[model samples]
Target: MHPLFADRPAAGRALAGQLAVYAGRDDVVVLALPRGGVPVAFEVARRLGAGLDVFPVRKLGAPGHAELAMGALAGGGTLVRNDQVIYSLGIGEETIAEVVAAERRELARREDAYRLGRDALDVTGRVVLLIDDGMATGATMYAAVDAVRQRGPAQVVVAVPVASEQACRQMRFVADGVLCLRTPSTFFSVGQYYADFSQTTDDEVRELLRRAVTAG
Candidate 1:
């Protein structure tokens, strides 16, 4: 089968198409999980006439299983752990604390680099659209939703270009709504659906956020 997207921008546009119901809304805010999600959310916010912001979240990978997310930390100080994974692997508090400390530093660094002194947009009493390029385990989105929920958003929606079938289903339980353009049962990785899945650089993320601010 052909790839679903040429790149992140294409994926974003496709996602925006499905979200046409939200067009011209003043109370909508799109918060992207950077640095990849910025490009995706930029197009969604632009197309929907919504505000754009980055919701920095850092995944805590299981020790020795770097690709497996055991939990995540949100910018708003919310921590989400997969207790099943933690207990199954016998991960202790000392290990968890060490990982949290390391991820906290990285999360702060990314927030500073992406925001550049800008304050987060207020989502109180408004619809919050949490976007990401893709979801593997849904750990990051769970943490983001948990953090954002505390701030009193009227609604929280999780959107992605493509995701594993299981991940999309899990999100539906937490998010007020969930929209995924593609959910392949045989999903290997997010990059598989994009023809040009290049790594999104920090410079690109910063530039996109700058443009989003200007666009707003």
Candidate 2:
């Protein structure tokens, strides 16, 4: 009915409320899927008094239909493909490789720009709160969850302000805890639920990460 969030910061604060159980835990870390997720994660990390960092991930949207995710690429070569989309669309392996190649370049560029020489935060034996603005097909978030899992985090928690009903269900299998503040069955798009779904910039992400790191 009403707008679920005023903006990314509002959504992040709402998400942080859902994640209050993690507040003040030294072993907890919030990893954002920049650049949109950074704002949200910044609020969460601020509220929870947790370390914050970026976990770069790029979505591989299907050719000719860029909104439809065929797969995603996360750091450390972790990839999760939507086989149903790929098979149904008859997307070839070469196409997949090409998409991955292109996205990897963007991912690397984002990591470099966002981190600005800071090393990726280590998640070993800690609780990793993997946050995003929202989830549609959950492709990119799924890949991020898998990539973080490999680094031996004690737990992986997927948290978002809103998501499709299917996505909320899907993430349960990937993370130790999945927190979706709203799972609308009639969801049209993540942006539809937000009053101001503005584009998040690299500068904004870097600034938030700088504040988080400096506060830590």
Candidate 3:
């Protein structure tokens, strides 16, 4: 079993330790990418006494290859795409438009479901800590950073349990500080580092968000 997933909460607790400086800072907010990132962020948020919430992003998958994201769209109109991937895949403009449109709808739905009557936390002039379980290509995270930047945060910090060295480097340019727990020289998929990487369900995401909203 990979060390990152010896236990899910343990992994998060370990990550929290590395982020101790941010503890008890009211100006620091932790925004986690759902669904896998929520559990990890929960531990960090609890330890730091920081507010936790979800930031939804949807991949603009290539035609017939849902796992291959040519681009991604995050809630708040942030869009990031790898044109090379689209060109290599021969994805047409119409197809790309369709995928982005569909993804936007899904992103909005998730935001509505997770946030409900609660208002989005104002990021302006505050330090934002973006958390994810792990990153592979980082396309999703790039879009997320762009989305958060649109809100005019005072600073953006990206924290993750594990990621490829390349992904970590790329993310550093987009964030003020990057807190990556592990950056293996020979990296594979993010799942390779996790023991119980079971898919997180929508119901679980909703419940977690509900709890976060109530607690904050």
Candidate 4:
């Protein structure tokens, strides 16, 4: 079995097949972790014919290592930190606070930019399929799941194309369902599995969100 994917869309299409059970349900909504997850979730939302919306999340990247996720912050002011990464890397509360404060600003900015004055979809009593491109440390996805839970989703399913084995294990407990198309034992980063893992621009996210809404 090849774990590689051509890109986020390709991976998303593959991931949607596993979620056929949620197809065409009026009470189902697909919430993507923008801006990367937007593209992936768009395909899923399109396939399932579900309403699509953004659940903004920002990773609290480690100091001096912006690529490394020390934790994450999501909507509803939810934060999930990796204690092992924090304690081992000597990340202090002061530093962590600084990171979260900055990310919260960006998260708010994205929520506004992506929505473009459109109110967020009401997820209460709906089956929320929370989509992200992939999972590595899973801090971001965990934060998302936690935040969504507070909004009273009937079921929160964490769906991704590829993820580390450990990430999948941690998600299953917090999320009502976890569907990962591939769980590679040798996973390092989400980008490694994709052939064309280029950045997803804000404009692209906006366009896709419009298309998804129009398509529905």
Candidate 5:
């Protein structure tokens, strides 16, 4: 086990402990970002006895700096971008359009695969907890929050294992509450803080959701 994530399951367990106050509330729902977030959110939803669902968001990568996200897109065409990054990268309107178009398709495909025939949970006047594996630039998670906010959730809480201090501060402006276990000032990529930062497969995500629904 990596020292940072000595016991992998314990990370989720810790998040559950922090979120215990919200347990057994009918007005609360857990929305996990697919792929990596599913497993972490599974533990949280189970512990909270809250309805679990997926909230998909896709990153619009800069043309040359694919890892560097210029912006993000979420359901219902909620787009959030860092104008400084876009301008600095010299990302033109045409490039942004193309990237967003491609990401929208991918987002739709992921949503279809994850949600299947299950109806999306109504966020109207409900406390919506958004979960992801971790936070980097926070652009993607911000996009998710922006998309969910459109449905008029009573509150928005973002829970994650680790995040940059700056990212956490930025998220505070958007989320009602930000629950982060570790916010290191000398932050690097989120994966660096995880001992077992293996790639999460689509099948794994599907199985996690299936199990959550079955357990419910």
Candidate 6:
């Protein structure tokens, strides 16, 4: 057994195998979380012969504890908060507002940068496969699910190369199906499971999107 995935592309190919049933289906579409998820979804989409698009999501971490996600924001002005975390941490409405505002601006910028004036692909009445590099707390993926749900997809599937067991369980309740290649009991971080988990640059994402569009 290898220590971890060779990289995101390798992980995407692995995921594609598990999702082969959806291959060549017109109603199936792959939605990747920007930055990290694009590369992984690229392979999945290519193998499955499905359309690829980005579903931008921004995590809203606590004011002091940046790693602790209090909620998340997605496109279409949709925001989902973890009320339990908010009440436990005593996060005020004002602080939540501030975080949401900052994330919304960043989300908008990313949408513009990635789409470049093109409209988002329609997910209505489609089988939407949401892909991410991996999930730790899963706040962002949850937000993505919520955003897609609003669009009336026939079904929603959350696919990741690796994720915490707990996060995987939580995601199942939100999505119609969940596909995780690895759920190590001793989960540390998503990057730890990838040999070359480099930071996915904006330019790389833009280039991948370009290739995906051209291939289609």
Cα lDDT tens digits, model 2, 84-157, are 99999999999899999999999989988998998988999999999999999999999999999999999999
* lDDT by residue for model 1 (1-216), tens: 689899999999999999999889888999999988989999999999898999999999999988888899997789999898899999999999999999999999998898899998999999999999999889989999999999999999999999999999999999999998999879877888889889999999999888988988
In Å, residue 45's CA in model 1 sits off its true spot by: 1.0
Residue pairs clashing in model 3 are none
* Distance from true location, Cα of 133 in model 4, Å: 0.8
Instruction: Name model 2 segments beyond 4 Å from true.
Output: none
Off by over 4 Å in 4: 1-3
When 3 and 4 are scored with TM-score, the better candidate is: 4
lDDT (0-100) at residue 76 of candidate 5? 92
User: How do the predictions measure up, each by TM-score?
Assistant: 0.96, 0.98, 0.94, 0.97, 0.95, 0.95
lDDT of 4 by residue, 104-195 (tens): 99999999899999999999999999999999989999999999999998999999999999999989999999998889889888998888
Instruction: Report the CA-based lDDT of candidate 5 relative to the real structure.
Output: 0.87
- Give all candidates' CA lDDT scores: 0.92, 0.93, 0.85, 0.92, 0.87, 0.93
Residues 98-194, model 5: lDDT tens digits: 8888999999999888877788889999999999888889999999999999999999999998888988889999999999898877886777877
10 residues in a row with least lDDT, candidate 6: 1-10
* Clashes (N, CA, C under 3 Å) per candidate: 0, 0, 0, 0, 0, 0
Stronger candidate by TM-score (5 vs 6): 6
Comparing 2 and 5 on TM-score, the stronger one: 2
Choose 3 or 6, whichever is better by TM-score. Answer: 6
Candidate 3 or 5, higher lDDT? 5
Error of 3 at 201 (Å): 1.5
For candidate 3, what's the RMSD?
A: 1.6
Which model is ahead, 1 or 6, in terms of lDDT? 6
Clashing pairs in 6: none
